[model samples]
Target: MLTLYHNDMSVCSQKVRLCLAEKALAHEAKHLNLRAGDQQKPEYLTLNPKGVVPTLVDDDVVVTESVVINEYLDDAYPKHPLKPVDPAERAKMRWWTKQIDDSIFPATGTVSMSVAFHHQYTPEVLDELTRQRGPGYRARFALLQKGTDNPNFSDAIKRLYKMINDMNVALERGPWLTGEMFTLADIAYAPYITRLDHLKFLGFLDKNPRTAAWYERMRSRETYRAALAAQFNPKYLPLMEEKGREAWPRVKALVGLA
Candidate 1:
């Protein structure tokens, strides 16, 4: 039996769901409400020590981390291969995902927090999140406290813009990041692109036709609707927009469009 503990809007969770959906794998879904402190509960912490979303339990085996879980699904299932058969291409896949973690992930978190999330967080919520040991979450708490006046905001936007440009350069190799075949590399970056779009960072897309094309193709995939778009939480739309629009000008100027 396969069971997954995940949150609706978590990009990591959506990656797992995308892999599962692509493989036509059936799994029990235990949707956790991260906002309600569900991930912090002792029971969940036992499963995922980091108190994060998208834990996959396959019979007696458990998997944490979205990238790890997606790889696990491909390895365990093997019917629908998400990894490249060639060693070089597989290595490229890992590099793509790693670049996202090292570059895109941090900026996306800061942008999301500096805009929408910081507005919603109270001192108590910030304190609770602040107490969490996860580096990214703790970093988010710090950014949240910075409010919209973050000095690091411009740098973060530039970093993401650079990453997007690099992605476009990578895609110039072929239709997909890993050539003609779509693999975990595409899945890894797609959700981040979606989040950027939501934050009105479409400006990044305009300059990178290849990345823009790849993202459009991703949207047309069935797994995208089931995995990414379906899980989008519209509840945050109002704040994401209000703050996103307010922040876009500064972001634009940083990227030299303004």
Candidate 2:
């Protein structure tokens, strides 16, 4: 009875898909072709003003934003509850979820965006594309220059490190980020962090064995595995594979793909 608007490869959408799958809830999936700008169409825009993927329509109620959707699903189902009863533990889950989103998501986006732009257009053409797209997009487009921008790269790297260290500390608190039990927090963080690790931009965990172990544990879950196996542009695969070629062995070893 739920209709989910999602792109198979989107980390945000994967979050929702993982939650729904874990709950064994059957839902209709309408895959948005983001590359074709389907999300910007009038019909889809009526469902989500922001025109983002992973929009969930439950009966008459509509929910956008992956994190919010995760909470909504957990609250709605309440059978196999993802959030624990303890207020403190729930608070910790929310906190870590925010940390994961704010930190890992952006850095990975920057890296991926950089690669995408380069693959799609020449520098001169890209410059024209940015000009036509406007400042908001231009700023994102400029993420390609992160290496030259010390402040930018430093901030990204610092946030990535903090995300790893924070999770490591959370592990010290207990098995899961919130404490003993696994919850929505793990589901939220797994896709983005695993994608980054798969890309080998995970120096944060490289030196921290605790976080490395935690990374391994998170990827072992069926939900996480299912999410990673979602579809994407086959062309992008070889590029991601080639770009992260050096990381292949380590990534495979970590995820048991080896």
Candidate 3:
């Protein structure tokens, strides 16, 4: 039996869950409340030293990173393959996953923390976060404390633009990122792009119609709906909308969208 330690609302967890659903794999779920700092606990740290969610324990084997876990599942299960057969397309899939981790995830984090995290965090939570993590994480909390954009905000927006345009260009090949079939690349980017839609600064999509179309197609998938509905955190939605509305104009201006 596979056991997964994950947070429902964590985008990374959502990706892994979607992959599991697509492959029809049955697994035990252990939900971690990220807001309550469950992930920073010692036991979880033992499983994943990074103190992150969506750690998959397949018998004795442990997979920590979400993308890697998805890949592992595909290889281990083999009933439903999420990776491409062609070498070039597989390379493209890996590159797309890299963008999800290296660029899109950071941009989503910056934008999300900037807009709403400051509104929800208490002093105690902030203190815990600062104490549990290192200088880098504390620095991010500092920016959130200020209730303003981090210095990375501009860079994140720019990177989002680049990622969107790149997706659009690849999508011209039609139906999916690497080509005809939906692969891990699509599963990887789905949540981050949806985060942008939720934040309401999706001009990137407007400028890139193909990606928008791709998103709609993604929405039609059973796994997409299941992932979103299963993980939609109602507790955060009100604040997300409140602050997102308050910050959208500034965000739009910063990203240079009309």
Candidate 4:
């Protein structure tokens, strides 16, 4: 049996869930409350030393990391392949995935977390943000820092702008990131792109028409929809449902899904 240890609001977790949906595979899902630190519990830590969400336990083997989990599913379940058959094509797919992770994911995470934490939490993370004084917030901003000397927010936005431009260029090539066929690269990127749209970072799309069209394609897929419904935050559910028609089709098409 396949079992997924996930958190509803985690983009990485949503990636794995979407992979399962694409494969038309049935799996057990265990939702971890990240704010509650359930992923850090000893039992969960035994499954993933890093204590991260979206850990996939397939029989006895455990897999951590979203891209790894997605690849594993494609390899282990042959029904619907999310990777390219050609080796060179596969390499290109993997390259785009890595690029999206390095450039897109962290920026979206930092900005969204900043907004959400400010709005949702009782005691704002702003207290944490404030201790940084003028520039350096000392509360071990390590997790979201992404190996940069610049302050976290500055670093995140820099990477984000680069990623948005890169995505726009790729979309001009049409349909999916790895060209006409949908591949792992698209799957890896769709969730984060969907997230930016959710945060009304839609300006990123408006600035790049190709990206806007590409995103509309990605949003129309059953896999993307399933993942969105299954993994989006309940707090964001109403918002997501309301705006989903606008966001998901583009993302689904981006992943080469209907």
Best by TM-score: 3
Candidate 2: 10-residue stretch with minimal lDDT: 145-154
Best candidate per lDDT, number? Answer: 1
lDDT preference between candidates 1 and 2, better one? 1
lDDT of candidate 1 at residue 149, scale 0 to 100: 66
Q: How accurate is candidate 1 locally (lDDT)?
A: 0.84
lDDT of each: 0.84, 0.71, 0.83, 0.70
Tens-place lDDT per residue, model 4, 1-258, is 999999877888887887888888999999997755677678999999887888999999999988888988999988878888888888888888787566677676665544333334333443534432333553434433332232565556556656767878987776888788887777777777777666555655656777778777878887888876545676875554444344344433442333
How far residue 66's Cα lies from its native spot in candidate 4, in Å, is 0.8
Listed per candidate, the RMSD to the true structure in angstroms reads: 2.3, 5.1, 1.6, 7.5
Q: Which model is ahead, 1 or 3, in terms of lDDT?
A: 1
Each model's total of backbone clashes = 0, 0, 0, 19
lDDT of 1 by residue, 1-258 (tens): 999999887778888888899898998999998777899999999999988888999999999988889999999999989899999999999998888677677788777877777667676776777676544776646755675567777787888888788889999889899898889999888888888888877888888999999999999999899877877888976777777788888888888888
lDDT of 3 by residue, 1-258 (tens): 899998776889988988998898999999998888998888889999998988999999999999999999999999988898999889989999997887788777777887776667777887888787755876767775554356777777778778888999999897999899889999988887777777666767878899899999988888888867657888877777787777777766775785
Cα-lDDT of candidate 3: 0.83
Could you tell me the TM-score of candidate 4? 0.79
What does candidate 2's lDDT look like per residue over 1-258, in tens digits?
Answer: 999999877888988888897787889999987655678788998999887788999999999988899999999998889997999889988987786566677766655544332354456655655565566865665556442242454455455556776778778877777877889998887777766655555655765677788778877777666656645446655665455554345433433334
Better of 2 and 4 by TM-score: 2
| Model 3: pairs clashing at backbone N, Cα or C within 3 Å | none
* Number of the candidate with higher lDDT, 2 or 3: 3
TM-score of every model versus the real structure: 0.93, 0.82, 0.94, 0.79
